[model samples]
Target: MRNTISLRIADFLKSYPPFHLLEQEELKSIAEEITVQYNYKGEHLFKQEDPCKPYFYLIQQGAVEIYQNENGKEITLDQCDEGDLFGLRPLFAGKHYSISAKTLEESIFYLIPIQAFKPITVNNPKVSEYLLSSLASNTHTPYYTESPSRGNLDLTSDIHELQTVHYNKKLISCSKDTTIKDLAGLMNLHSVGSVVILEDGKPTGIVTDKDIRVKVASGNWDIQMPVKEIMNSPVICYPASLTASQAHLAMMKHRISHICITEDGTPNSNALGIVAEHDLIVSQGNNPYFLMKALLRAKKTKDLKKIRRNITALLEQYIKSNIPMTHISRVMFELNDATIKKCIALSIKKMNTPPPCKFAWMSLGSQGRKEQLLLTDQDNAIVFEDQDEASYPDIHTYFMELAKNVNKRLLKIGFDYCPADMMAGNPKWCLSLSQWKEQFSDWVKSPIDDHILLCQVFFDYDISYGELNLVNALADHIFKVTSDLPIFKANLARSALLNPSPMGFFRQFLLETNGEYKDFFDLKKRALIPITDAARVLILEHQVKNINNTFERYEKLAELEPQNRELYLSASYATKVLLKFRTRQGLMHGDSGRFIDLKSLSKEEKVKLKRCFNTIGDLQDLIKLRYKLVNLI
Candidate 1:
């Protein structure tokens, strides 16, 4: 009897490697015995010390990371993608695995059983030579490394970029007889958003959260109603062997979230699993799992710094894929936040005892706003709870030591030190709640040029760690002082309008006139800052809390004032476009995205940027109107 699954497996295997060297009958025979396996991101296929299975693995789809544990640091030896082979060493050695192989992304693997294939290799010289070549060397990975013998494995590198629509393998499904109440219970128990209704071991229909919300919760049906009444029949089905682009197109065409995978890519076959938009997202280059896996196993600052390097690769991929800048920023923010929190925790462990007082590490400026894509200088401060005057010295010393360690570790992890000495390690920036309040009051009361500049950077501070109540209280105090004071607000707004529309009298991009970036476009100064500053001041005027992100602030503003929705939305879109532009420029040049060479930009790129600048002009003009800063401009 022929199995469609094995045929599909054979079809994939015949495209690459020693399998490609084999005859059709021989490949089919081997594929029939091949075991299909699925693994999620970060799962170990085989550990370094584990005995080899009867089979070596081929990455049918997705990536496999082969890494070595060296002195407690996981050094990534190689990453294998589609049609790549690994674990072949044990076949010849008959010993424990040398390196740990794990999934870097949600993957489909075809297991080539060694026991069943001994005769085939004995007959085929090319197959034996290939297998021997891999097992012959300790560090040689045929699919990963390019060498004289490897001779262009012809294995696709871009498969990771555009193939394999990652499906949810958990297979959360229900029978047609299942009641609405029972199905809901099952969904809750599994913590899944949808369930496939199965009949005769094949998917017949599907039910999702929306179905329950509209059908049962909206008073349309009782909980006792069978799911057959609710489940949408004629389910959208595809084979497990589908590409990411294909799945994405299918999902969009069908207007559905869940795509059921069946053996024959039809409703009549056995339900294999599902593919979701969320799954595709998780499997993509923006995958936090890969970085987090590296993060957890890291024991030294250099290891973490290596992880940061990988983050650049992820960012490059995201930008290349044309993923929304807003989404990319959020992922980058989460990764950076996690890295900072881990750094603080590591710092605390370095201390002799626990912290003497509650403290919050605040990330100021770009990081605070969560728009930090390209890493630049660190801008951070420490906010601790007020302590006894006598005990202040000891508490301050302990926190100072911890800050020094964190700052050093952060520096090692690729964040350069602030030129102006604004880090928490500095005594002036590190302060108690009362001291911070006093400082903010002083800034507001003074509103001098230097003070305003300091306020622009400091006001965006977000608590990275420690006591939240202290930070919340400080936020309230800052808002209370600035909410009623018009001069402070107007001054801040005026400064936001200082950078004039990012275009000079010639209507071309206003390039920096002097310094290292002379004749280059100041991406951050000329465009990004004006919109960011405007978002900050306007959102503060509305007294809206918790919207620190420039784009998000504009989104909230659009919601708050429906009349100026278009203006706020325009500003929001401009911010996103500029951020993406800056991030791409930074990635290309390997800089902080502050400076851009005008010669590098294409005509379309230049046009898009100037359009965003026009929106910034509109924003700066609105600030002039609202704050009555006609004289300042």
Candidate 2:
């Protein structure tokens, strides 16, 4: 019986929560029976211990604070804003309210009649389970204890339980008949300090660089002497996946610096790869310099692509090495950025001229922020100085052509083309400075749908190349126009808050229900972007300029907002962890770091993800409070 508006509410609600279990007709019926209530700022919807109303509430517009008395003090337990379902205790437990629900600002809420909804809860098993789980979570018992059967039992194991030692997979070997010069050439080519002498795919002996130095150069053996002459026999071998402790014991037992990884755990089983003690130590330590250098020297897109494979190798090494996540992220980001920059430089060289009249290419979204470790779609723009109207077409043509080449090159470099086509190649994005100023001004002043769309992309402008001054000028214009536009800030804040929390009311992971990523969690959109966008808006509101790095911006914001420092710091840590998780997932899957298979993650990873979600929940509450964006949508 509900009209389009109520049906839309029903449609939205059915995408989440207990409502999601309802049939379309049932949802529409519930939607029709619901009463829409609007409250002004600081208004109370219900007070603690008040008699239960006939209905539970869902935030249709603004935020509602759920406050509970803990010990002697009233503390804010949680905040329920748009699309958030609240006040379900009455329906579930038939009890008076244990918490007070109040409007943080002007708010609209849909009150669903418990009498009508109760029957569906009893009829739908999924609905019943969802409500029970939701109530369990809100009741504040330890999450794992609520369902002992489903608890993460694996967490009982110590961190050491997950420690795994990886060895090199490729083994360098040469036949005994090979000349010493050819053997040395092979060793130099593979950058290995030693080579195994194999007779018919079986390791017969090994010759190290030391043997070459002491035996050959010292005149004990000739340079032309066969590797078999200087080779050390009785080589040791071990199975792959040896633990660090076991590897140490094996090395001690054998008194050898290198262990040959072979089939069936013996030297006889054909060498797979050499695991030198030095290589093990290096793998255990944080050394990104080699990878960074590789990134810098990468000439072709294919070379960068190859280096990207090493990034995963390096990441696996780092995780095993126990490098701090922050250090890992910093180094990985530097390498990723360097690759992009090299790609840009190469793309520019392909251009006909050195960009007409000085322009800066800016990367937007995650890349602009330099938090992108896993390859994502490129979101970029081109900003040049305002040229005379007569010269505009020519300048625009040049930049557009350059952008086309750059975008194409980036696609080849592994950054998928933006689906919305929001790239420098787009005329809307490839703009001159004065034009950009006008564009941003319009977005700030009017903020129509298109302008809002543009703001989301353009707001995170980071200078990738060309004149820094031109980019700064654009930033100045944005601040100048937006300083007084509270509405614009609110809009951006609302956009940041658009993604529902990564967790459901039952505190289960929210998975993509549709698209190619169905059943997978969208860490990028649901988690990373929310934090990144929130940081950008807050930084812009503080008039902080040119700081596009999301985590750094949050760190800066923490200093600026003392009262919210802890929340911001937690946000920063969460961002880093989530970025690492996404990077690892992407590296494993060989795709953009977006959809993560929740089932594939270990228990520890799931727990870490949930912890990050807690931070996101807290940050979303803060955004809702600070921006007063509750009623905007």
Candidate 3:
């Protein structure tokens, strides 16, 4: 029998993980052994290196401050608020506490006996995993996640743009009184493009390659004169912590290169390093379309890798500029397509001869649909001209090798290897035009979950490179086959409804119940995927080919159904708004915009999100009614 107090404790524990994984009986039993403790504000729970407590603590109310002594100075590590679990790491590790935990305010804690807790988690993998994550500092609110995209999507594949600029640490600077000739000698010896003029070890001015050309070489000033006479004053300075995107933007905004790094983030401090525009271009990949041209000139795969870094920065720029996702997607898709084509062209040159036959490299799934805002796994396939056994083996070998090179290069450039092994390199996907038609026909006729999934992902493909006729022929065959199979359309519609309504009965956003992102709202899963999935199924029913974009699909739906025009138009607006919202979140957090921290949202943002969910609910209702999917649900 459980007491009221024990039951209440169990209820609170059930909301969080490890504890959440426990059975009701187990929870009640464990809760009975839990002891309650109270702490005043600014009171220490445990100091660093203190012996581990017999009980692990859970925050019942208020907050806990976790800090560590780093180099004789206290550094705050994290804050554990309501329902947050702490002081469990040392108990599990059989060691002293590595961090000091204290109360941030007047707090109540439920201290569970480690003896009771250990036995419960012994056989529970999820509990054990959650405990390990907590120990590793991967803390999240009981029913919430920490950052966007940590729930599912890894929108920040290239963290380069999000991180601090990798500046040149070598200080190529001279005293302000140094002669220009001496500064030139120092610059030549270091092979630096710019020379920082330091006054009392602090950067005061900078002289660049342009200054050397215009001011000194042009005889506006003599090289033998003091460097300060020709040096540009009030040098653009930034802190060492300046991000790649910020550095790039600063250079463009100030119309100058070579931003000097200072300790205090001002020229009043010692010059630490110099970050040039050329360095930013070399590191962050200056512009997206320019990076596309750079891809063409790339002789090695590493060059493509560098340009891809720039592409991520450009993505940040696009999001910050509030560019419509449609325009951004188109530009990004073009850049990606251009990269693939260039890689293929280069691979052909590496071969003993050109491709024996014309073929089309097809970008499937998100890339196929031109909705890839982030660089995810490469989902692609190949379709070649049909040929008899005579020329078949040669063409097959050529395309296979080409795909292998392209896939490997794509991986090197940031796209993860698709876990499902769905790429042109896979023989099942890499096929002749007739074979691809057969594949599509088989999927449509079968209409099983697996087959329907294949239809959804592969059917959206566009010609990335090679022959257009091959892809067009395949697309024509697909619409023709899908038109004949109503069951397939029904299956897709069911899949769209699988995402569930994003909002709850109380009009609150439905949060994920578990996984690493427990309690975190999945914006992509709940909102974006629902809309995109609905769009895909609806567009497929109308036999509308080539519009893989979610918003565009809704737009086409509006045009097709005038009676349901308002609903379709509303879905279109909602889709665009949701995409923009997700991108903004992802860019802000440097994560995939899938999982969102609801608490971090402003009141206005929350209202906008709720409004969007309302629209999504309506769209889903439309899906249910139009497909007659009430029975399926």
Candidate 4:
């Protein structure tokens, strides 16, 4: 007979994962064994290295925090709320706890015993898998924290590489004798990209949309010809047990978009299904392929705006899944790049004439660094090749009109206008190659506060569209001018120290005292800028050009300065943590995520954020001493 408390617990358990996978009888049986416990805010459920309690916890009422002690300081790992599970690590490892769990608010918990749950995990694969996913999600940090090659951030260890891909079981096929026109009809009717050519149940060859478009639509071949005329013979085939990585490799090797799956892993065997590049992308869950395709097909600014929103959605998903920031940033960067390119393409069509001369569209600031994960203000410039002075006016006027159209369209596409008039449409930013080189040289020679700030923004520029040589020329000019100037480097490093420490005298976050964000921590100014500024100065000192991403800069700095590798690597990890934190905050509140409210954060969250500050403080000290900024400033 079930007691009222046990019944109520079972009802609650049914609503969440792993528990929902169990039968009603099984859920009740497990709930019968759960021991109810209560704790006040700040009470430890279990401490680091504590013996494994017989029961792990399920939060029933309030919040809990999982944290670990590193070098005598507590670093929060994750926070849990109602319906979340904690204390499961030791149950799997059969060792003392690696971290501590504590209540963040006065809370009630259903402490599910290990014995009651262990059998369920063994009997139910779905339950075990769900629990393991939960464990994997919460246990690991976003970027690797303790690997020796930590600077490199190995992205090759993708889980999708090992996971089996599900292919299209409904194979669309045509006989070798079928007319190309009928084959096209078959593919159009089925809404499939490729059609397998089969004879006697065995695979023969394949015809794809590309084949039809290139061969028939291009007027190179008649549609009345048999498919055998255009079919890619000896179809590249894989076994039904093909993984996404394997499929991707095969696609790349053969330079084909589709692969035939067969009963055996060869073309000689009976065909089973088809795996296209599209299938592999869809299987990955967050589809960059679809987004890129949408960008290419986008005809108007509104279409591009909708696609940019999708990119944000993808970013939010990536953050929630704990995808490595290195991977997430690269994906977002590419998508962002594609959107900018598409915008330029659409804008050029609006013009009555083509570009007067070859020009490079430079995306500056966070967009330039490829660190932008959310919609932000436009920061862009234009660098066209130098032309004869007599023709320069016409060229400049033409490009200015082009820049205005692009900026206005970008504004329409959700990238807000630059508040400081820093975009390409501004007459000051749109310039010839020689003019940009002169401008950069002047900034480096001057090195005042404002000039240094402009240098910081412009130096991270990457070519979004146009001639690469012009952008490369500007970069070469920057490195050449700043190469012999020690004082310029010193001033640049001094600028890194301009922001006060993220932590105040009491070691609390230095919150903004007066502004729209009063009492909110200035995350960008206090933390991100310091690290970015330091990286730029250090990388420039090394004369390493083109590597603009902040974390990548730190990684490069680590490699270049072996003596300071650990510190540089720590700075890289801290950049990831801060960016991830900011991205989360932005997604949660639908804002820029620059100003974080102290009151809204859990104690554990505050601790996690504080961990990054140590790295920033150490980095600034290094800059101050190395650059002799102490004496100069």
Candidate 5:
């Protein structure tokens, strides 16, 4: 007969794997021998090389992170949540534990004794095979696959951006004729922050808690007024079938907190439910929303710097959870953009007077392309409105002071100064619109090998602040000059192919011959830069502007050239793989992930990294042939 505790344990065990394959009586019998334990957050369950415990663990609640110490740094191998089984590999192998497991939160675990579980595995071939396969693959469960060499687990697919979002089916709504007081009451009754305004069974407008607080309470308006007066009309609506990424984009693009879900995703259709930014934040467990809020509220540069640490932590969590790189890149880019905007805002306050004229702050290189993830050197420039020679000196002087203050804030916030002095604070980079145009025209019309490097850096500019028209005009000037110039494109292609192939004759990584990083594989120079350079030249030739990201450029290229769609798509995938690889290496080593130590890589990892080299070689060949750079090289 089963006791209450054993019955409770069996009930929970029946839902997870292995035990899910067992007969009820057998599972209950095994559960009777189970011992339950409790742990607090940050507590360690086991350490690397410790003798294997007599049992394996199943998380009943909370989370555990499995990690290993490498060069005195803890590298996270896997994270286990409720209903996940761990510590089974050591038990099966009869060897010491190779990694340490610790609680990420206060946790409750059910320890299944090996003595009791061994007999069941022998009788159930399915259970034994599952365990053996999971152990051999270095995976904690069948749901995730782990790489034996890097210990990184693949938990998500690349197309997670297309996953349908979960919206609130229990939508709180009111009639447009309802008074503000009643609408507030309706929202309070349902414990919701928003109420959709419906007219004739369709959403006509939406009123949120902010509307009430900002208009009625702050403006001291009559509470008896109809909601139509304060409610925002033509409510943003999307189909109930909207994906998570789509929902996020809609909310961001509209600058709204809530989105109305309708039958047809248009305001004309009947409302099905509502999706809140908060709901998506909770669903995805990525907290860019809160981080943005903190950034907006921050008063000092130190506060912004502190928030950047949280951003890094959030980025690490996203990578570990296997969030889609596209979504990750977008979130990080927005946060970085916001940080810079806030810095400029604070810097303006330090000035005795406002700007002399319209200007635009430009972020260059990787940041301009929206592909930056790690805290790297800052690359920025300034472009103000074109001015006559009379007032040009004064306008330039005022903006220069402002740019210097902004640059100092960024450095304090952890972005290192560019070793080559490529920041806006430099007089050479901070220029009037005409000077920038002439500078670009000079580089494009006269394409020197050395000048191509500067062109590459300046071409991918994104406006961080000030006037957009200024930057747009600059972009227009670039296309105008480069559209008819094939020589420049050829030189750019030659630059892309300057680095030797990433792989040597014997399938070894091409190591740097000499430098501070001697014998280390330059992932950036050999792999990333080639792909980026090719993308830039190809996009320029096609007259495609605003698509600066290398992978995105390849994806766009795939659409434009149907005959070579396969090659372009392969380049896109390879770009993402290499970016993620570099990010992981940076996070582990606490430095730029450009230089890779070949000795540290597992054979499996080496093989995976090498797989990307084939696409690189093919891309270089295509660039050489398409640009007629064979003779030039």
Candidate 6:
């Protein structure tokens, strides 16, 4: 029987491929009978039409190319690398090989007996499904037919075709006796460049900004000139339902910038609104000022909540409009930050008095990092001044009361309470400056479980309000303490690598098999958190303070670590792409943007996700090497 060496091979095999579906004992039995074959570069394992061998191959190292004859031409079908399985088709077909399998480079492969594999597949549905799915994905078919059959078929239809129609609500008009100045005032009030001369609400000519600039403004006509003096005869009018494309075409056909929307299709009908060429472009949902204003004026939690809905709606519009994710993320972050600040301000007003002493309310975790796209949980803290011994307790009590109100209101506004309860409402987290320093000192010196938990939660504290000095002092204390504790950084690095990559061997998506999110990929836990944790740890190691945004942190890290600059930049790019993807998914699915439905993604999206995984893999490698975590796993 094969011994420990073969068992090791079997154990590795059991982690991936068809072997993973076998019972442990059954797999070990197959492994015991397998032969390890080594091939040099350009060596052929099997040629076309050769008799089927008793053994099927699993690549141990290097790569093997599978080629099939197409008419008179030899076409390479696939390349199998380490841990990849190939040459299994012959076992099932029970015929001579249909393709030639040759080594692309020097390689080793475990040859499992076809006789052993056949028995295991007899009862293993998962093994059968996995093998069949892999085979189907590797085969070439008509592009249109192949895609619709795959799970990602729906994403093609998800691409929204921009609608042509738009709202034109800016109407302009003036009485016949109205002076040129009054006509101009009417146009300016409506923020338009033209005024229609309406005599008894019938067909009339129109005055444009060009007329004002040329005749009235240039002193060619008196300021008191009547509407008849400068108005262009025969107004151009269209119905309100004109699509954006049609509007553009009409404007181009007539060589005009504006189209007057009238009650009827002609200039004889009363004008309702004007559709300008610029309006069509701006109508594609480039307006964030409206949402910002709504947030600022929001008086109650319900009002803000209603406006928050609008913000998300606006976000969906932005994504659908194909705006750059960077611009959208920044705008969305600003709006969310402003909303939180407004909440805090309103909360403070509801309190008995202004804060007792100087303190800074901080947002922690994703909110702290400004990478929170979909609202998740409330992770926040408070840092008050170090008061005298007698007054400290009273001050702490007052801030805790304030925090309670704030946290409760925030919860009402839709942010879930932190599962760990690491919120400002917790007296343990809401502390004075000296108390915070003492807390950090304890965490750094001990590095215990609870302390590590706190470190992970609180390390990303971002100043949200109060005295900047108070927050700066807290950051200074953290840097001072953590700079001396390399072990803490190492612990953080280990934690960052806790989630193994979401990509399996052979580059297939690794999805959650069970739990609340069965069959869905946990983008937050599997992808985002690891990168965020890594960025925080790496930045802390660099003694950088106050930069909590994940992409920004990585960009800063790239600046600091020149050797790993490319990797860091790639990490930053990946973080943005994943965040944008999550935001889009959340907007589409109406959830917290944590779980992604792999079946809904298109092939291009799948490729983008794979690219993100590559970045994650590279970053994980850096973390492992830097922390010497090879032994930890």
Please tell me which predicted candidate would have the highest TM-score against the true structure.
4
Each candidate's TM vs. the true structure? 0.59, 0.56, 0.57, 0.66, 0.59, 0.61
Candidate order by decreasing TM-score: 4, 6, 5, 1, 3, 2
- lDDT by residue for model 5 over 1-633, one digit each (tens)? 539999999988887677889999998899899999999988999898898889889988766777788888565555566677778865585678877889876899999888889989989977876676456434465423333142322223122344578989898988888999999999888989899998876999999999899999986778999999898989999887798778878888999999999999888989999998887866754357667878899999999999999889878876765444555676788889899999999999889999989999999999999888999999999999989889988899999999999999999999999999999999999999999999999998889976899999998889999999999899899999988888888888888788757888887788989989999999998889888887888788888877788887887887689788657866776787788789989998999899999898865457556757877888888887897766644
lDDT of 6 by residue, 145-169 (tens): 1221113222111111123355456
Cα lDDT tens digits, model 4, 481-527, are 99999988988888888885788788978888997889889899999
RMSD of each: 23.0, 16.3, 17.0, 9.3, 16.7, 17.1
Predictions in order: lDDT: 0.80, 0.73, 0.77, 0.83, 0.82, 0.74
Which structure is stronger by TM-score: 2 or 4? 4
Model 5 quality (TM-score): 0.59
Superposed model 6: Cα runs more than 4 Å off:
1-195, 198-286
Question: Can you give the lDDT of residue 382 in candidate 3?
Answer: 89
How many clashes in candidate 4?
A: 0
lDDT of 3 by residue, 153-224 (tens): 222222345457888998788878899889888888989899998888888899988888888888788877
| Residue 532 shift from truth in candidate 5, angstroms | 0.7
157: Cα error in model 6, Å: 29
lDDT of 2 by residue, 391-454 (tens): 9999999989988888887787678999999899999889988888888898889877677777
**Model 4: per-residue Cα lDDT at residue 218:** 95
Sort by lDDT, best first: 4, 5, 1, 3, 6, 2
